[model samples]
Target: MGDLEIVKRAIAGDDESFLLVMQVNKEGLYRTAFAFLRNEHDALEAMQEVIYRAYKNMHKVKEPSYVKTWLTRIMMNYCQDQLKKKKRFTINETLNEISIDDGTVQLELQEALKKLSEQEQQLVYMKYFQDTKIKDIAVMENIPEGTVKSRLHKILKTLRQHLTEKGEMDHV
Candidate 1:
């Protein structure tokens, strides 16, 4: 069935249809959550809360074509709330990874991402990691598109400087 069909089903109280939505987007949402929260357990909790909230409020959504955007908006809010509720914890020296290619590069990239502030990390993750477009990210983040571009540009510059200062980049 098409995405619209699924959305209609979900709105009509098909819990399993909601599950399908969650299943399709769960990995992306989890990774996005991880990018912000940085704690696996907290990310999981936030994602769960997001899914639950989405399910409860599915009826409020008026457009069938906006399911993806709507879901991401919910995820972003859940993450922000989670951030506010939890006293932030410092990440340990070591970060985890599951790279298919160069582990060194992956580790460094993860380290660089961790160096970013939470909002910047989320912007980077949504833009590149989840392959989200700037406009969509802006909507999901409830920010202006120009702000998204500026934030992403700033994030890239920061990451480049950080990697260079740390000797990860020689000619950046």
Candidate 2:
């Protein structure tokens, strides 16, 4: 069945249809959750919560085609709330303890990503990590296409500069 059909069925209170929707989008949902939580257990818990919330609020989704984006936005909001709670419970005594030469290129890139604003981080993830198109990202983010492109360009430039200054990327 098409995604729209499945979403319509799910919203109409078909349990199997909702499960199908969850089954189809599980990987994408998990990836987004993991990217934020960075722990397998926490990511799994987040996914469960996202699924429950999606099921409960499935009727609030306006467009069937936008179901994926709607779920993603919910996951992002949930992750952000979890992150805030985590920060409150955790202590960061080694904020300055990271050494430039201590990790691989991927690790350095991850560190640089953490320095970006939440919106920038989400843009980078959607554009690069998830390979989402600019148009799709704009729709998902509820912004104009030109704005998405501009923000992505600026984010890439900032990432490159940050990596280069940290000696993580070779100047070209």
Candidate 3:
């Protein structure tokens, strides 16, 4: 079965097809959850919650072809909400404490990503981290495709500047 057929079946309440959908998308979903939550435990928790949410609301899916995007958007929103609650309870950590100059590119990139607004961060995650297509991102975000492209270009520039300013990377 193809993606659309499988998604349609899943939406139509086929348990096996739903499981297949979850199985196929698990890794990518986990990575997206981890990116936002910043730890394995929280990522796993977020994954479970998102799975529950998606399963409970499967019938709300309007476009079977965009089922993956819909799931991802759920994960993103859930993570964002969790982060908000976490921030409300925790003391704010300074940049020096949150960022480490450990010579790892990934860590540096993550630190730079933190400088972006939540919406900007989501755009980056959808476009780069999840490797979602621009048109798909536009649809998920309910924006024009041209707007998505412009935002991504601006986000990349901001990230590059942030890295350079922090001495994490040389000017390109």
Cα RMSD to native, each candidate? 4.3, 4.0, 3.6
**Model 1 agreement with the true structure over 101-165: per-residue lDDT tens digits:** 65666666767876788677667766787678888777666789999998889999988887777
Clashes of 1: 0
> Could you give candidate 2's per-residue lDDT for residues 145-171 as a string of tens digits?
999989989998998888888883454
Residue pairs clashing in model 3 are none
Instruction: List model 3 lDDT by residue over 36-131, tens digit each.
Output: 886788899998999999999999998888888898889998998998898788776433443455456767787788789988988888887788
Show where candidate 2 strays beyond 4 Å: 92-103, 168-172
For each candidate in turn, the TM-score is 0.67, 0.84, 0.84
Better candidate by lDDT, 2 or 3: 3
lDDT of 3: 0.85
| Stronger candidate by lDDT (1 vs 2) | 2
Total backbone clashes of model 3?
0
RMSD of 1: 4.3
The list of candidate 1 runs beyond 4 A from truth reads 30-47, 60-63, 73-102, 168-172
